[model samples]
Target: MLVDADDCEIVGEANGSAEMERLLIESAPEVVLCDTSPADALRVIEALSGEGAALVLLGEDHSEYQLMADAVLPGWAYLRKEADRIEILGAIRAAGAGLIAVDRSFSLLPGSAFPLADAEILPPDETLTAREREVLQQMTHGLPNKQIAARLNISQHTVKFHVASILAKLGASSRTEAVTSGARRGLVSL
Candidate 1:
């Protein structure tokens, strides 16, 4: 589906690796845009290699995929989900031309070339309830408590409660921080 422009035609779409493999074999578009988690992106990339299609991956975490792309697929582009429309369009076009287009902010290497020694160490497994996880997922869209409550078929008060719990569990002072932390921890996808 076309998101913000009419000039670019969407040849195909897929939700998972198997569907993506089928679409890649059927359509073989010059460029493929996939929005998924890092692990899933790896699976999709592996599933469609040698198909001669450039890949543009949009995800919450880029470092893992960046490393993989550098080692395996030079034509792949990994952009953060929060990337602006211009960046996304540029990445797609560049990838279509068989070139690499990466977000400069994210490094293509693993681990700390520049480590933050004092970074907050979140617990290895901060358990979030199912409802709280759903609320946090909605928060990633920048939705308000009212809209999230309506979408979840819950009361606004309940949404607020879940949000508060999410923030506390994530050690975040605000909704934005909560989403950011959740994404970094692989607890939520963007």
Candidate 2:
């Protein structure tokens, strides 16, 4: 089953660890959002080591997954369930871009800690034009071409033209891939 939220899409859903691993192998999505216990989420993350998929874990507290993220998964995000929608989406976007995006709430947790060295910093490319960057940011919001055009006060043809240029510049074959590349290159923020 597929579920769509914000600018992210869930290509598969699993009820148990075994099923989740199977789905991960089969679908190979760019990012996996898991709302399970820390232990369960750890198992899933370990199982996906070679799959090249990023993770965004949601739980009640930083204690749930902080250590694992710090020690095991460097390019992952652990967000509290009560996190803001923008932060949640940002985490997902960052994970898809192969970056760590831990929520600020975690730092406020009593005795919470993170390994500074675990954070990954991607270098930005300055190839995109100002207009193209605007289009790319709107793409991260999951906007369709028409809506992007209307919001940017441009015609649909212009939006399409920008999208095509973005794809070509990023060497991406699809819109989603282009957005992922943009995020990875620090060119777009969710």
What TM-score against the true fold does each predicted structure earn? 0.51, 0.52
Q: State the lDDT of candidate 2 residue by residue for 1-190, as single tens digits.
A: 1234656777888987899988987888888777787568668767766667778888776665545454444357888877667777788888878787767666544335442332332225527888998999999988999999999999999999999988888888989998887765556655
After superposition, candidate 2 runs with Cα above 4 Å error: 1-7, 70-74, 116-190
Residues 65-149, model 1: lDDT tens digits: 5344434443667777888888888888888777776675664233311112224435557568789878998999999999999
Which parts of model 1 are misplaced by more than 4 Å?
Answer: 1-7, 70-74, 108-190
Count clashing residue pairs per candidate.
0, 0
Best model per TM-score? 2
